[model samples]
Target: MFEVNRVTARSSSLDAAHWQRRLDVLAENHGVAGAVLGILHGDDMMSAAFGVTNMRTGAPVQTDTVFQIGSITKVYSATAALRLVADGVLDLDKPISTWLPTLRLADDAAHRVTLRHLLTHTSGIAGDVFTDTGRGDDCLERYVDGLASVPQLLPPGTGFSYCNSGFSLVGRVIEQVTGKVWDRAMHDLLFAPLGLDTTMTLPEEALLHSAAMGHEHQADGTLQPAARWGLPRSNGPAGGIVCTARDVLAFSRFHLNDGRVPDGNTLLPRALVRDMRSTQIELPFYDGDNNALGLAWFRQTWDGQSLIGHDGYTVGQNAFLRLLPSHQLAVVLLANGGPAPDLYRALYSEIFAELAGVAMPSPLHPPQGSSGFDTGHHVGTYLGYNHEHEVLDDDGVPSLRWAATGSLVDVMPTTEGEYEAIAAGGDLLLYREPGQRRWRPATFVQLPDGRSGLYIGLRAYIRAS
Candidate 1:
């Protein structure tokens, strides 16, 4: 149980050493392979790392050991684009076709996509389109060209859909205007200027430091280092940056500083930085949890205190970054695997409650008796980018079965996202992994096309019924 001392919390006295020990025990109990916790409160900061980078190598995770930050890279990509806006080189509302005149998509309406659409995840592009163009300077260029034949899920700038491809498009746009690759631009613009020595965008660069390897749960119920490190290089702008906990906190500090570097040079305009955190679109569901999505940041509510940040997931690594800009506070947790989501829930619960006095909503739990919710809306086959989710009315009870389609069959985890979904009171279908009591919510929302959609693992699947 997480116990908060109100007096110490109210005083804002964060004992770093004490919390380090707590993290040590919590990481072990939750089966996390390796984890790092970084906190930023005003100008003061504290960080802790626990466990090994890789089970096979037995290398202890250090404070500076780099782990994949995943889609948190989107925020970085968005920041880079906003810099273009600050300089009057790029306009957020202008159609991207104005710059990339030859840009094409299967949907006719997609040609009108703007930078704002990409940043806000409303491009309606089929996101999991992970294609390997090659390890060359032309990779991003070729990746964007590949989208010519790729179909768009919905009309551009129409509705909410988590579009990874849209961010890759943003990377392409940055590459086009800057006359440099996305990785090189990152070094010249963000990393070197910000003094982020522990941050890198590729595996060869990660080899220079005590890098963390990703691990996966095997069929034999054991954790093993996976063969895959990350997705294609083309996907880098969307979810491929790797860095240390301290570096993440440092980056967070940069955001808190309103795009100013240590030398006090304004790398990004203060107005653009504020706009990025401002709510651009409200989600259809998740009223109190995730209130809305900003340009790249997630705008949320915790006990009515405004919170903004992003979370990321790759093959085996999970990362969370939450910031209370109002309080000038932030928390970042990067984990290698094994009950990471659960660990963060418990860990952040205590931290935020203590420091910010924000009450996180309780996790979904199965009721004592049957919750006979009408499974009518949920009964259908929901389909989206190489995935299918079928909600079945199993003898008057709702159950969700999901599977990866096409190339994902060879790439996804062992299971097909199987779950014994139980209908709940809050319009959510609850499911818990084997041997885990933490119930997860599978939300049902209406898609812009007026079809019922199921959101599982952050991706939305549209119902065919």
Candidate 2:
């Protein structure tokens, strides 16, 4: 980790070599099949690709190797919608039902759900609704239609829940306005204008490039080609974009340019671009202090400096993007297989510390200096979309137990009213913030109608007890 004060100028020669060595060591350490890491400091950008695209095929990972970026597509989807808003074709504050007429949520709050809610993830729709709506261009349309039967987890604009279905609905609105599919709309409005030729939304287009295959980690400690290569067509608007680390850096640079294309052409209103980085809601339980949600970006701070970024995971592939606007810096990492997250935490922490003079906050873990707080109130089964968490007190040891995944995580008190979930492998997985975060825990408050829930990572998990 290089300190900002310790370094003066951008030297691609020295920085590139240093980062390449770091990437190589990490790849070997984690057994990653292939990986790409990119960094942008002011006007200078450097990237290194290492390992094979697939262990089975032994295809080398080149600079242009395309990998599924997952939910980073939400930022592009949000940008497309902002374009429509810029042209007076759509309104940010207007209810989405006005544009996506077919969208009917189980809750009456559907009438109040606006484009802003969808963009900011405050629409209260369920997350992980990865239903396959077919490969036709009408996939987003059908996906929105199917959402009618989906139950609302909270009132629109009243809470935060990362909703892929909401972005799918936003895609439907883009289709209704442009009379084209979401992918086409994205190309016309953002990709083409930004000269992002290496980026694509479908498998066919991605296949034309040297693309990386997803790999799954096996119980025997080896990687095998994943069963599914691409997400369903319905997920395009949510997390279906495929691109290289270089192209992803270009996308990051475009946003840093205040919504301008490479040729200095204005693609979106600068104000809207600024608004995308502004706070929409507080997410204290997230990564760092003052963590919040922007229009589509996740905002947080490190060393009292603001940062923005998003992460994506599509089955076996994981990607991460982080931006420090104050320093005009961006770092992106794309990887395939199980050890991605571990590598990401280590690599990002080192890069950001050296390049930006900001310490990448360590993953949440119990403070060893202090004894754990009482875990009595937090003990219960909390349920969310297809996932359940049970906080238990087994023989005086507090732990978080997963229902479906069968993973038991020891809970060590990090501070008063907060606990860190220590994974069985001794890694810090997450922090359970009760009274300290903006949103309350399942036991924090009882709803007006006598219902209660736990707020973790912007999702409200109903207390299933």
Question: Against the unseen true structure, what C-alpha lDDT does each candidate score?
Answer: 0.82, 0.75
Could you give candidate 1's per-residue lDDT for residues 181-266 as a string of tens digits? 99998887788888888888988999999888888888898988877888789999999899988888888988998988888988
Clashing pairs in 1: none
lDDT tens per residue, model 2, 1-465 = 111111122455438877878988877777777888888888888888787777778878876689999999999899889989999999989887787666677776567999999998888887657677789887887887877777777777777767888888888899999999888889998888888889999999988988888887555756787776867889888899999887888888888999887889888878999999999888624543337989999998888888888988886798999999998899989988757877887798899889778997655554454344445655677776655667776664556654432111111111112354532212123445322222112222343335566555456677765
In TM-score terms, candidate 1 sits at 0.93
lDDT of 1: 0.82
Q: Quote each prediction's TM-score.
A: 0.93, 0.87
Over 4 Å off in model 1, which ranges? Answer: 1-13, 367-372, 425-427
**Which stretch of 10 consecutive residues in model 2 shows the poorest summed lDDT?**
406-415
